[model samples]
Target: MISLRKLAPALCLGVALQGTTAMAEEVLFYHDKGFWSEALAKVGDASEAATGVKIAESPYSSAEQYKAFVQSSIASGKAPEMFSWWGGQSLNDLVATGKIAPLDDVWKTAIDSGDFPASTADLFSVDGKPYGLPMHIGKWAVLFNKDIFAEVGVEAPATWADLEMVAEKLKAAGHTPFAATVQDGWRGFIWFQELLLRTNPDAYAKIHTGELAYDSDEIREVFQLWSELFAKGWFTDVRSNREIEDFAAGGAGMYLIGDWAIGLLESNNLPIVKMGAFVMPNVDASIPPAVIVEGSPIVFSTEAGQDEAYIKAAEYWMSADGANVWGAASGNSIGNVNAEAPNEILSSLDASINEMGASAVLRWWELVPAQLQGELVAEFNSFMLDPTMEQAEAVMANIQALNAEYWADQ
Candidate 1:
């Protein structure tokens, strides 16, 4: 059996829960809070006006916390009809519980209209059964500071070699080359994982499914490259220590983050002139390929208390108009397949991403199985902090061994 978790990967985006009044039929929602909740509320307001269902949301922090709440709720025979979340092993795991309602018709309508790429629908499917709607088409890039490059008398990095050159120059000037936050365990994974995408994509994917070992030659090359880069003093080493300027603080030279980083940038009143983004350079000799996370942020309506009205509201929240408002508020590109997102940032970012065309790469975290996620992340994290040749080999071998064990019965 082809493990659904390993087939297609991507993550997040959602809708509001319904309220109690006729215009406020609340939905029980567990979300990552902040923008997701606030943006979803706005989407719900428009949706309510258009569809007479008010979406109400109960917020939470982080996927792990939300999922734990969900597990306990289910154990107690309770689950929210629609909730917000990423789609990877995360969604597939939930689908396996037989609690999630498949939105086959909803997705088919979307696919038939060409509103969503087949990959979007594939993210939430398990065993050929559909489970969620397409809500975001991830727009990703490596965000950097224009001023920093100018200060160092360097141009914006145009390729992989450019990255190495820029890193060396920035280091010589004694400016932190990269700004990263490890307080959030997920953030570090972004660095190693993104590089792995350009370094060893196929083996990386296979590793996620327990097919290839983490210690494989391809995997070793990935870490060797990363370790060599770090040993060159390119990284800020803020993973163990707090960064001089975190992603939110805005003074760091560069950050490899989602397009949503633009929103955080703007909200801080930092001028866009202060920053820009570029694609990661390909290490492969087959020219260069752009990569990004392609799945939408979806609100999984698991039926909290009263999900009927809430689900309908969640459906409406995904409309073009609703998505546009979300895009504007996000100060980032709307991940929605049919998003009429109005923000200039989103438009500009979207235009840039489109130019990459078929070369854009989606992230591995979203495509790999749920069970294999933690293992891969941990191994990568080790390499990121104190990367070693031995650790690199062990990481790949451990991954391969784990993958073999994980899929042995499946």
Candidate 2:
């Protein structure tokens, strides 16, 4: 095994030390996070100890500002050594700028060593070259209140019919079957994607690539199911900011979100013992199981990748040891398959997903063409607030129009 620390000093060449003392050279890391600052700092400490390169973080509270700053910095040839970024079209755009470095070698190393699954590399790849390492790989599941399930005399559903039965029972017990919201705008697609995937996974994947029309029969069926759920009053107010809190307090029976939200639950003081997660059952049982997976990648600037020290540090960060340190600090699962899960709930969820042979579908927000994301999300938000058949029809038409315009331009 090659050691990063052994090669660090020679690779760091002209890099300045912290003081006159033999301190590790520091590299700037940019990310959009006001809440995870401390957690990231801890990860940085571990990186320095392992790689002989101090990882200094610069966090931004406003995502818009953070994106603008990063873009401008890259354009000015002053991009940070490393930065957190999204995958799919967003990453494609960054790679097209010729500023981001392709980390194919780093990816091959991790994949061959069994630290990460080869499928995960697809998330950060464009033209078959990966440009980043996974920061977080989130699996979407229905997080239910264990106490509420027990009170309703129900267990996690195994089939679509059982899911509806569980929901009806919870509703009868004066509990909302699920918590949902469109408050952040981007969240509107959560249920939309989940329901669509459960109903027609092929259509779900096809729609993102423009191979399936949004206004087709397959999509209409999804919207019809969504309307019926809303008509049954089984979901929380879409405008409410307390969706997670309501689920935590047992006011809502379940919340469908990425496992990364486990951190949010913990931050709100929700007891892990009260929480349980299950893969959303397939509405079309004939199809194989699937779960939405989202990834955040740490990308390197082209300039930074030229530095041997930065390359060594990136390699270290992709290893099981580095990923486990990050997982421990962030209270979330890292992409490394060899690393232990952050908590028992996540561990159980991972095992369940693997045991069932579920397919990992990318989340809609990142999977869809970037050009259409905002407009389509706005349409979804509108439909969530007015979940009528009429609104669903109109939203479908509007979304199809936007989708067509984007594909036409392409």
Candidate 3:
């Protein structure tokens, strides 16, 4: 096991705080990129201070790498004592391995103490047993450049017609109505997921989990809408950076992304006032609006030697202080109701959720089974790269085939 001291001096406090034994028994925490410096580090320091247990954090540079590392480690019977993961299907899959420890005791304490709400707790559970604690929450929306919108003389869209009108206006003004990329297959997922939710969020959930067919009329409607958007030339270069140059340079009028991008946008020197975000409009007026919410979780391993230390670390990470630190650093809304949002962007997200009463659907990245997710992304990429009625139908058929094969085993 790697020690925290070897990583950095700031993280080395674990040794001096409780001596060699506690440092040796340190809680090894692994997470994906975006949390290494400001977010998770702060939580690590706070956890060590509160529990006298050193936390050695190892952050992988990408989600793919992190997932691979954890899976391989677990297979080798050497997974970290605690590690970050996505909720929903991702957490359930980890639970199936029988290596993850249930945090029902810690969850009960957090709920009673008001550190977390029941809704957030339920998100990280499988079959009523809690498996992890949320590290941060993200609400997905359309982030537009205020300058570009002003130039086009259009406001944020609130309905499907309004969205179409705004798109036409932007295009007429010689700007891409939307910015997206298919070079990386996952980029296509943002559009597909939003369209699904806009069509029927309940059906979206059911289809992803295999309770409904992916090629059904409901899902076909989603693709038809997406195809229409493509036919109208609503999207920009699929290869450009979605959050940075593409939207920031006014090449694309709008960018659909999660709240986590707010920090990235702000860091790019775009003034907060110039960036505006809104919930994606529903496809039909009769359907209520809903937003996809994604939360990262930290799950614990049930390995014999590290249960107590893992529990302490999980407690600290799930507490109000940890959420506050994480929120302030990541600029993403947190699941802990008691924790305050760090910036205006996050504040707006929280307000929108409450105002719209949006039903939380797990984002596409984490909600789908890993292999099925890859297949879905591949199909979406194929359709976007050369969108046509023929391509859309083929993609739908492919999805049905993939879903049938994948779900049959489960």
Candidate 4:
């Protein structure tokens, strides 16, 4: 939990506190100081204005911090009434702890009303009972600089072969081929996920869900391809720079990142009008680009003895109207099947994304046993320091072994 001493004065003891001195009824809604949280606060505030419901706010950065706070609070019986969560094993673990409440009733209504996509809703279900709300059904799209691509004489790559050709052409023109910030370890995952998606999408999903071995030949191949890209100087070496700001500021040809990068691009005044998005270039065009559907799910709890208002708030969040409001506020695509996107660009993209999504698949990150994603990221970081042929294989093998033991213990 956030150290009480570190809490803002208003939360520590002042009137902003939603729960009483007895701390009986409160919903601790958390967000990191990012676009999503800020956007949530913006639209959620409007929701409150209309509905007169107040949710207590707590913020933290990094999933580790969020997990630490949640875990600590469970012991004190001061657990949050509801907070952002994800599906797969992550939600299963929480439910097993007996703190979380089932969302079957709300979800049944949502499904019947067509508020969310079934694909996304299924992620939050445990044994056919929904435990969380599906927020964003997003497909990873590579946002690139159109002006930069045009200047470099590179069209959006249609396939992995085409992408390699573009990267080489950019290098010949004396430009960095890709914008990557390997200094921050988690950032390395953009490349890893992209490569994994390209090489074998189903295998990628399986490994994450503990159904397949992480160190298998398929996983090894993905890592090897990543190391090969480094060997070809596809992106900057890790030692030279730690921040993507330089990469963005540099006249790099492309940045293989998710849609959220739009916020960063617009914030930097990078031209999105000239910027365009496409599925990450597949290593083999014969294969469809694997899209990752990543966003946080909101999980409620019975531990806090929250007032009926909290449950109503959770239901309100999953409403179709809430979807449009959330999408408008964040400038990000949402998962609601019935919620019409407010922006033309996002709507168009969403249409194409869903069309391809029917044939392609999403790699479930939240399903990966807890700590596996973190540990794999760490190993990838170590490789960034000095990517060797063995480094790639070693990384996957270690993760596979560790996870095998991890799941057995469960």
TM-score for all models, in order of appearance: 0.81, 0.88, 0.86, 0.83
For model 1, residues 1-410, the per-residue Cα lDDT tens digits are 11001111221111223333222344444566554566667765666677766555567766567667877866776555666556667677777776677777666666676666666666667787777655455566777777778889887665788887888888888776777656445565677677677776776567666667666677667778877877776666556444423643544577777776676666666566576777677776464566677554454534421345655655565556666666666554434567665445556556665775636555666666676676667766776665778777767676667777778878
Clashing pairs in 4: 1-69, 85-297, 137-335
Q: Write candidate 4's Cα lDDT for 1-410 as tens digits.
A: 22112335555575346555432233457654444666677656655654555445667767667677887877667566767766666777777777777877777777788776566667777787677775555556666667667877988776777888888988888887877665534665667777877777777777765788877778778778878888888776565553445545655767766565665566556644756777776676677645666665677776432456666667667776676677766655556767766455556566666776635454445656765667777777777767786776777677778889887876
RMSD of 3: 3.7
Overall local distance difference test of candidate 4: 0.66
- Tens-digit per-residue lDDT, 70-149, candidate 3: 98989997767778887777788888988888888998999999877787778788999888877667788888888989
For model 2, residues 1-410, the per-residue Cα lDDT tens digits are 11123326644453454334454656777898656777778877887888777667789876567878988988997676789988878889888888888898888889999888897888888898889888788889999989899998999999999999999999999999999988655788998899999888889889988899999999999999999999998899899877666666676898999887777777677877888999999998998998888888899988777777677778877888887887777667767878877888888998899999998888998888876777898999999999998999999999999999888877
Query: If the candidates were sorted by their TM-score against the true structure, best first, what order would they fall in?
Result: 2, 3, 4, 1
Which candidate wins on lDDT? 2
Model 2, poorest ten-residue lDDT window? 1-10
Question: Candidate 2, clashing residue pairs?
Answer: none
- The residue-level lDDT of candidate 3 at 258 comes to 80
Which regions of candidate 4 are displaced past 4 Å? 1-27, 33-35, 75-77, 117-119, 209-213, 237-251, 303-306, 342-345, 354-360, 407-410
List where candidate 1 sits over 4 angstroms from the true fold. 1-23, 33-35, 108-120, 127-129, 240-245, 248-250, 296-307, 332-338, 390-401
All candidates: CA RMSD (Å): 8.0, 4.8, 3.7, 4.9
Which candidate has the highest TM-score of all?
2
The CA lDDT of each predicted structure is 0.63, 0.83, 0.77, 0.66
Model 1, position 131, has a per-residue lDDT of: 75
